[model samples]
Target: MSDLLARHRAVMPNWLALYYQDPIEIVSGKGNRVVDAAGKSYLDFFAGILTNMIGYDVAEVREAVERQLATGVVHTSTVYLLRGQIELAEKIARLSGIPDAKVFFTNSGTEANETALLLATYARKSDQVLAMRQSYHGRSFGAISVTSNRSWKNNSLSPLNVHFLHGADRHLTQFKGLSDAGYIAACVDDLRHVLATAVAGDVAALIAEPIQGVGGFTMAPDGLFAAYQEVLAAEGILFISDEVQTGWGRTGSAFFGIQNHGVTPDMMTFAKGLGNGFAVGGVVARGDLMDAPHAVGLATFGGNPIAMAAANATLDFVLSHDLQANAARTGAIILDGLRAAAPRFPIVGDVRGKGLMFAIELVDPETGAPAPALAARYMEETRSLGLLAGKGGLYGHAMRMAPPLTLTEDEAREGLAILVTALENIS
Candidate 1:
């Protein structure tokens, strides 16, 4: 092991996962690429697990952060009035689409999800909830309780009695044979059955990811959540969209990933892409539900000045540049190319994506089972050839790719070529 990596292993927890067999020490980044400690520059397709939304070394965000730091008041906490916080709240609330929406800032997606669950259960007065299989919300105590995927969950004991619903995984699920309409009906039926038989009283909410990010970019039919929201509305159970990965036009189809489902959720939690590279996350909900809690809640570092400044600059850059449109147009090129080339790559089982978020599932040629080893090999090969990709899935066999929304057509083509070459070598 390298000296730094050895020191990291000595100090860090064993549970903290690292990518690649021998991890690359990233030193600096610019535009859509990053350079390692060894001076090897590479195209970053995954964008630091989709957090670096606009790309690296963005002058807009960097300058905003520098300007804020120059003032020297970095940590006033939530007790004081922070202008950056208020502006960001207003912007997010306006874009949230919920009528009379309010915002609560948190330090990360896990905290955002925890806040959503707190509001949900407090308003409904229930400790029960519904979640989808293969869905990954966050890593908080409450967030993990609602998360159904074993791959993402480390603890089985949960405070809330979470009812896991079947619907999300399309490639290897039992309902894989069903068409879109049939799949939706089946999943909705499962939701109904869970509500009727499993629970005794009210369910606080049904929290879900539009596209299960850490579960390997798996998603249900476009309208599956819309159908679930209908059933949930009847019983007054809230629907929370965990848009940490799918929000902020990352999906290419809409600003929020849930918009494609044709329904408005009662609450939405977001984090990953909003701050670009800085740490920012929050929950947006209707005013009434947001006001349900009588007790005071405080996130000590939730809306810190630096994070807010970074988020504001990133949001401004994204909107002013029309990055959403670019994501659609550029992402289409990558997805279409991958699908067309799939015919020649036999070990590749699937090529799926929406907007900039996409995945390629690796499987054994003979058995068609998940080949996580092959996926790891592919990542190493790609890294060796000046590209960086990410890995996830229920079985750790899916190569997750979420380049910056600001990726140029040329960048997309270059990254796509590197990916194809990697796949070819692996196959």
Candidate 2:
């Protein structure tokens, strides 16, 4: 362990951090699994937080990348015309059903989101950005400001004028006099009022994670988008869907996350599965919103040939394999299994998600309150038993599982069995 620590410390910066590091250096990955330096393997349910869509080291992606590398033109910024970049943008535009949409590539989700933020701010000329609580956009200044996660805001570097929408708050209280639609309407109304009063003339855009992935993968009540769209359209505010975590086929749907809601955002950002495990992120915008005020975005490595190749091949693989249908089918199995097993355990509070992106919330057996401790215990135990699980939700009480869409029914069943056993141990 000391040797591993010393090696990493000497070669890598301290900024590389996420979950626990057991000094087990990850050396390789294949379909739905990863191996550490010690050569032990674990099924990857998180999919690198939903990035490895077609699974790790897919042969098609590798072949495409290799072909591009052999061509020698790797780092041509948007300045010079690049065929791979043009081809990728055209393909994404066609598949997204937004033919008039323009694509801007970036290095990661944060950069893609940053591009969207700048475009929104310039196009609307507004300082105020509205976002929903428990929503995650990205970690950069503009994206962080618009992201409703308090931890991101509490960190001192955040800029001002980013307002919380309070959409998730109303659900915490019981819906006494209102139906679910009414409750959703009320949330939109609150936003309308906020735009009128707090935003006044400073409203730039309303940014939301269409399905709110890290926010418990919460699906908004029906008719939520129609109401919100009415408010934003009236206020001349651009609606940007931060699909960084929910794009591709993760939601068992095509295009952006907003597609599931049947509403078109003025602009949407995508990362993660867009390039599978490759390093790429992109922002697509409505034709009118494509007009940038000035030269605000010019990423040197944005539309590199290698990344474009990987993304093109990835899109092809997703369509050819019909992975979206698989995600929906397998997701149903996981959800149903959880529902059936919940009665057997006092800790399972709720199981909710769409398609491959799902989470099981743990709660106190007596009070039914969020149980972060139990979640932590379950994750620790699962790892020891050879299963890698992820923790999420605002309270860190939901066990998030977003495996590769290619995960088989038997593999999913095996994972659920491990989860059931983990719960049994806790009980």
The prediction achieving the highest lDDT against the true structure is 1
TM-score result, candidate 1: 0.98
Q: Write the per-residue lDDT of candidate 1 for residues 1-427, one digit (tens) a residue.
A: 4999999999999889998888888999999999999999999998999999999999999999999999998889999899999999999999989999999999899999999998999999999988888888788787888887787788798889898887776664677789999989988988998988999899999998888898889887799989998899999999999999999888888999999999889999999788998999999999999988998877799999999999999999989998999999899989999998988987998999898999999999998899999998998999999998999889999999999999999988998898899888988
**lDDT per residue, candidate 2, 1-427, as tens digits?**
5697888788997766545535456688978888877777888788778888888888999999999888786777878887878898887777666648888888898898888888888787866788887888877777777776664454655554777875554447654467777788778768877866776685888888877766777767546866788877876888888888877777775445678767788888888888887899988887667766666557799878888899999988888998888888887888888888889888988887787888888999999889999888888777666677677778888888888989998888887788788889988
RMSD of 1: 1.1
TM-score of every model versus the real structure? 0.98, 0.93
Position 91, candidate 1: lDDT: 95
Q: Model 1 shows how many backbone clashes?
A: 0
Q: How well does model 1 score by local distance difference test? A: 0.90
lDDT of 2 at 40: 75
